[model samples]
Target: MTGTALDAATTELLAGSLRELLASVSAGGELGPALDALGWAEVLADDPATATTLLFTEHGRALVSSRALDDVLLAELDPALPPAAGSRALLYPHPAEGADPAPLDGPLWGVLLGPLHGVDEVVVPATAEGRTVLVTVAATDLAAAGGPATGFDLGSTWHTVAGPRPPGSGPPAPEAWTRAVAAGRRALAAEMIGVCESALTLATAHTTDRVQYGRPIASFQAVRHRLAEAYVAVTAARAVLDAAWTAAGGADGGGWAAAAAKLQAGRAQAQVMRHAVQVCGAMGLSQESELHRHVTRAAALDALLGGHMALAESAGAALLAGADVHPVVEL
Candidate 1:
């Protein structure tokens, strides 16, 4: 959902509170109850744009993971989803084989890019008889079919399970799936914005404090230019994402927003990671530094959903198919 454009004062106020909450969240604090206490449900219902951007961006900035992506996807694509009850996750098609579908009476192969603390079932998107469909799989079945799959995110889970779909959910609803994927892309772009921002922040701090020739390396022109380039990339990507949300309901069923957001963010992620790693130098790999953690998360996000190559191809194909995606940044 495109966020309701709240006044700047209100947005700032919400950002301040969200910043505090996410700080605690990254330090290993409970989130669900606190979110409910903060009227998260109301905010999500009333101002989803604010909720999506502020919450997910803060999540990425803190290097924390949650079921927020699941929330965004279900909101747009939940016609066939389960009733809000116990724990559940909507697993995306595995990036390696994004279009693969679960064979009828068989299992689903997908990637679940989050924690598996108390999840009960995973809803996987698959194709049946040339129609995109959702298939429900028990978490226990995921465990039985195969243990965790290899991935950059240690907390992430792999889905290869089988289960019964709630009656009516098995029917093909390609439109809903399309909308869900679009929502997923936007949510991911927001997260990447945070990721790139954090990486830049860390690099900026590191570079400023780093000494060379009895002077702060950040004072050097070359270092300054490198960081400047990184900053521009982050800003441009952020602007693109903002513009996309403004046209959330675009031609081609709004697929252009999704594609454009993902493409720009993917480019920014690559640029930010490269610049951060270069600036941080050997310290980037050290356990004492936080840069590595952000780097790993960036890499994982880059792979998840789609990397640059895949995203570019998909975007080109979308444009070729007559999808309009010219998002004009107003400010």
Candidate 2:
């Protein structure tokens, strides 16, 4: 699906609220219900903030935390986590033990814990700078979401993070990577759209002003056709992006849909932006021209989210292998 740019106001609010959420979440007080108030998670006592800024080093083998998670526990559910490298203020989640009331040692834990389900099914907090932040975790679909002091609703299940990585293995969970890929896709799509729109605008304006045969190039049938083709391509890509968003909206079967959206966006965005530059002619290639920036942005997008060609090939194969595809919705 095409990604919409988050407005400045919304970005600001999320920034502020995210910091507050991190504070309350990291505090390890009554969870579940509190997390429900945030769009990040649902289920009473099912989520606890275990947000941390993690860096993936050397094929995801080493994860270094920027913050201190000493107050929380580390459950290490996946067991695929790599050894930690450097350390800052780091908190981690631990699998819930028995009824022993143990005080958190402070800024360090062996095992890790995380919110098992509800709300954060699609989203996880990671710093944009790829540095330090808070972390959280919770259990899904169980009355005793916690111990005697904690109880969680059982029927609901979703996804999000909880704690630090384990000492062995490499990288974090597949889910974390999945979320990162999705974010990268959204960012790429948004950038592509921006490029396509800018190219169209530039080409349209230039053709209107550039005269050939005593008339503007805009009057030429060939130029008109080029613009129309580019517009159509942009529209089609936009549709696919919209479909991706619908597929991601609290739906359980978003995996293939997400893949398809990214794949389509990757192709169409590349094509439309390239055509935009071509239609703009020599002026488009000029360093001073905004068209060049758009072209560069589009290229950057093509490389992000595991590269467009690879992703599209994989998605196409999945579709050919009888994987169900979701239809795009008009917005």
Top candidate on lDDT is 1
lDDT score for residue 164 of model 1: 44
What TM-score does candidate 2 reach?
0.49
The TM-scores, one per candidate, come to 0.87, 0.49
- Span of 10 residues, lowest total lDDT, candidate 1: 159-168
* lDDT for each residue of candidate 2 in 1-331, tens digit (9 for 90 to 100): 2334444575455445544543444322333343347553221012121111110011011111111112111222112233332321112222231111112222222221223222221111223233212222222222122232121211111112223322221232444434334433543454455456666778899889988799998798887788888888767766666566565533333556656555666676677766667767787777777666556545544554445677766777877898656654544
For each of the candidates, give the backbone clash count. Answer: 1, 56
**Each prediction's RMSD to truth:** 3.4, 16.7
User: For candidate 1, what is the lDDT?
Assistant: 0.71
Clash pairs detected, candidate 1: 3-49
lDDT accuracy of residue 261 in candidate 2:
56
Q: Which portions of model 1 show Cα errors greater than 4 Å?
A: 1-4, 26-30, 82-85, 99-107, 115-117, 149-151, 154-169, 251-253, 326-331
Candidate 1 residue-wise lDDT, 150-203, digit = tens: 455543333333344333346576887777777777778888889889999999
| Residue 313, model 2: Cα distance from true site in angstroms | 0.9
